[model samples]
Target: MIEVLVVVGPGLVADAGLLEEIAAREFAAAGVSGTLVRARDAAHVLSLLSPSSPEGVGCAVVLPGRSAEVRSLIGRDLGAVVWVDVERADGVTAAAGATHLHGRGIGGLAWGIRHAVHRVRHPSRRIAYGPLPEQWGELYLPGADELYLSDADGPPVVMLIHGGYWRSIWAADIMGPLCADLAGRGLAVWNLEYRRPDLHGWDATTADVAAGLAALATAHGSDALPSGADGAAAPDLTRVAVVGHSAGAQLALRAVADAVAGEAAAADGAQAAEEDARAAAGEAPAVDGVRVAVSLAGVLDLVEGDRRWVGTGAVGAALGGRAPEGQAAPPYGDASPLLRLPLRARQLVVQGAADDLDLVDFGRRYARAAERAGDEVTYLEMPGDHFDVINPATPIWQATAQAITQALAAGPTSRG
Candidate 1:
């Protein structure tokens, strides 16, 4: 008779009972005769898998949960037994499957398994940026904290925006390792920290990002020179690019639009108030003048916020209830990149084929909108979920880095 072993990671001894139940159910359903064996820890599991064991156990099912230490132990001994992982989050099982498990019927299961694998592989990075010794007016900068690899400095600065439905609890620190990997490639990285809902409301968070960008630029002396090509006398500001994931992507686009609008309003206000000229002008306002924008698994359409894909209250919070609707959308269009696509920025959007949040359709919509508006937009559909793009070891991460490198190498233009 074939035998199966269930190895529970340390601290999850209680899950052994549940693993037994699952194994029994799955094995009976699949017409496989197997007995479940529980291991106290990863080492115990490895010891049991040795050739010295009773010779009948066919495969080992390792339920390490999120413990990377345990997973590493099992991976080293994978050749000895057919390794399987049972992922658990918050004491609830997330997925169970073999290491090489694949099939159309198990796509969702596979995605969950991949997400767990990614967590084990990449891990998080930690970093801190200040509530500076000098405050910016009454704001009392809260000193942003994030996870990023140290020593990220290249010709171009790439900013990675993490998506936590725009909530503060999910900071950019989650993407720290990925930032570090990019930094390892000699890319200057600004893993930003901004006010989120827990700290401040949506509008405040939005303004905080603008302030943060300004502060970052000031700190790096990016504003000292006029706009010009990369490697020119232009202070290397030309190659700056923003890579935003999920809600962060929406925010990046809005930042660009807001920057343009602020400039247009200020420049025009200073001129003679030519009502007819202003009314007849067809040019769109630009914000922050972002040269290139990339969105990974982004929620781009705010009008569809109430839809099951985008989620409602969160989008409302992000826009401060000021998002435009119907014909009104065009007037306040600067708040969304979809509405602001007329601005000629080089844009790239990547979405996961199995994204559980916002779905890949959201990224597709934004890409189509940008392309229709005459912007150069590249949309890459990778195989993974919403969080997979930030996985340091994944091919999606490499593709993102390459895209940024290519965009930065293209130099800068005043238009986007």
Candidate 2:
């Protein structure tokens, strides 16, 4: 028994009875039985939408009269009841001799409701594969990060880090589709959620990731293993490959650099100072003994980022406000994968040609830098925007999937 509630705006109050009659007919046509509730204003609309109602509608159709009010109501009841906004026509004709709804009307309103309903019922599908048992937990791991685990028995375990300029608003759920894809390919996937720089700052997020990886390795009995290709013999840690999107790519690169720097510092008895410096800089020391790192539209060059318009907001947001004027370029330059290239592990960078945010130049620059540093870097450019790379329906996403699958199948290789 699907139920829908239509909230008419004040402007339509004069013809409220007529509009309600039209909506009732439309609902019957859509195979949904519902009642049209006329509200005096946006406030009255909210009152009707409160959780106290017993009918508990499955969806709500709102005309665009009070858009802000509609949005607020939807925000409060998301996942509980679907919301759709209707556009009205102002009597403007298009080439087809039909009036278009730019701003009052039943046609646009009905269309929006139907579209929303379809989306709610038919979300993207994901398949899970591998032998690892599913595990779920929330822990205050390294850098005081919140971690959620989904484990399976597979040859290689993949870690997915979402990109949001390292902002807190983004979560592991953003990578859900991607993780599902990797898992379906018979790989154990870990979807990691870390503290955003906005909440705990950059260092904390990095610490959380480092800790989470360490926890993952320890749980799988791979912590004591030696470094190198042969290290794949260790328990569930056969081969560690990280897939990071956007700023997550920056985090992944920093993780690798910190690993190398940690070893160097430890060997020279400079570990404490190094740790202090890392803390001050809002960065983690890095994960030790990773085999491969794949970055998707990674923002490697902060200086380049500043020069360009794409990711400046993200960088500024993550860095706790714009870098001070003439402050030696804020650690973003040093942290960029381009500057740290000649990376120890084999690297693959996949970028979208239509990605307006990161742009193609960033990936090209990183590739050039890697080659100059004698690092083995494979760059794959495909058509589509930033989000399309993870969207299964897009060809670019399929290409990325193939690249990852091939890399995993080939195992780790030496660039030198």
Best by the lDDT measure: 2
TM-score to native of every candidate shown: 0.56, 0.58
Question: lDDT per residue, candidate 2, 1-416, as tens digits?
Answer: 56777666565523666666677677776687777776677677766666565546566665535445544454453333333334432222222111112222345455444533433443322211111111121211111111112123234556777787775434444565666565545455666666667756766666666655654555554333221122222223546677788888878776766565576787689888887986786544444446678888788776566556455477766765554455335466456667676676678888898886445788888887887787777888888788887676788878877776666656565633
What TM-score does candidate 1 get on C-alpha atoms? 0.56
Which tens-of-lDDT digit does each residue in 173-228 have in candidate 1? 45556655765565555666666653466556666556544444544443322222
- How many clashes does each candidate structure show, in the order listed? 12, 8
lDDT of 2 at 175: 68
